[model samples]
Target: MSRRAAGVILLAISAFLTGVKYITASIYSTSSPNSGYGADSFKQWLDYVEGNLTTYSMIVLIAGIIYLILAEIDDFDKK
Candidate 1:
């Protein structure tokens, strides 16, 4: 695929991952207040999400940025 296409795909994936992260964070915040769970459990869940999903989101975001830069460079090269 072309650099522009790859960049677009990476950006789309990053956006989706970001949306998921926001939804998960909102769910955790809204539910934590009403739940009878202990603080430790909440902390553990937060840690787990941060370690896994959040990490993937960050990686995807970085990759998207890289792809975008490459696309820009490719455009420049063609000029």
Candidate 2:
């Protein structure tokens, strides 16, 4: 696949992952008030999500952007 296509795919995947992260967080957060058991559980969940999904989403987003930029530069150089 072309760099542009790869970049678009990566960006779409990153966006979907981010949306899932936020939606899951919101759903969990609203299910119970943040206190005692609920608060602790939420904290743990947040930590896990931030460590894994959030990290990967950011990396993918950045990589996608970088790929687009590089593709543009390559096109510019060609011209």
Global local distance difference test of model 1: 0.72
Candidate 1: regions farther than 4 A off: 28-48
Off by over 4 Å in 2: 30-48
Q: Given candidate 2, what's the lDDT at residue 44?
A: 66
Candidate 1, residues 11-56, lDDT tens digits: the string is 7887888677656755685577665466666555566466566677
lDDT of 2 by residue, 34-60 (tens): 533566676665665665788889999
Cα shift from native, residue 32, model 2 (Å): 4.6
Q: For candidate 2, list the clashing residue pairs, or say none.
A: none
Highest lDDT: give the candidate number.
2
Pull out the clashing pairs in model 1: none
